[model samples]
Target: MRTHWLSSCLVLLITTLAVAQKNTQGISGQVLWKAGNFMPTIGTKASVPKAVPVVREVYIYALTNDKQVDAGEDAGFYQKVNSKLVRKVKTDKKGRFSVTLPVGYYSVFTKEEKGLYANLFDDAMNINPVQVQKRRWTKMDVVVDYQAVY
Candidate 1:
């Protein structure tokens, strides 16, 4: 019957998807900040005695681990494509985050990219990178230690 054939096809598709499941891993961490003694910028040095802001939201990125890919002529195209492949995660309250990603190399970061002060530390250094492997949970901690230039 026609109904029987349709059911058979649907069952076949579901089985194929389950068999092709990709192995993935989880990543979790906190974003902490240490009070700064000084942050030198633009030929001027400023002192930050104590600045313990809330550690509410931290960003985690499972970035594509290829830095040597040359865009060549179409430089903008490469950046666009690579940005699309980035796996981004944000922490919840209490500075906690967990993300499941495919097994591969990744570059993690804790940079803040929101709010009116977002562009303040544009020239600051990036956070250290971390790697995640197959079916494993990687616990990585990040620290923020920069002050505003102005």
Candidate 2:
């Protein structure tokens, strides 16, 4: 009798936990610069450089508010905004990025510079709406249209 009751309780707990799980999924995309936009190398003797989108490492941030993360506040560039640090991720060497987040709405953007995660640099561009869905990957690609902070 005791064994039967324990098994029933265990089953109930498992079901409840499963039902309580949040609808979270993976989000992935790439940051790219148009190949044609970059012209021949200045220092290189080669006139025709390989035409391809430049793959680089950049900073990415997920925000829950309409306010920009590092909006012109030089200090905000490298400082981690603990108040709104929902998800911060960096793109791979190929400029491919992936992050798992709960299903909901978020404003996403990328910083021009790669390092400076803990130091102030400059504001980011390409701010846009991002949505995560349940049980699937959401693809959102962004292009670096502005110059990186030196």
What TM-score does each of the candidates earn? 0.46, 0.48
| Tens-digit lDDT track of model 1 for 1-150 | 999999999999988855543344767777555554545456556555543434444333334333422233421112212333355556665566777766655555444432101111112222234567876778866545444221
Q: Between which residue pairs do clashes occur in model 2?
A: 78-119
Q: Which ten residues in a row have the lowest lDDT in candidate 2?
A: 114-123
Off by over 4 Å in 2: 1-24, 34-70, 73-83, 114-126, 147-150
Which predicted model would earn the best TM-score? 2
The lDDT for every candidate, in the order shown, is 0.48, 0.54
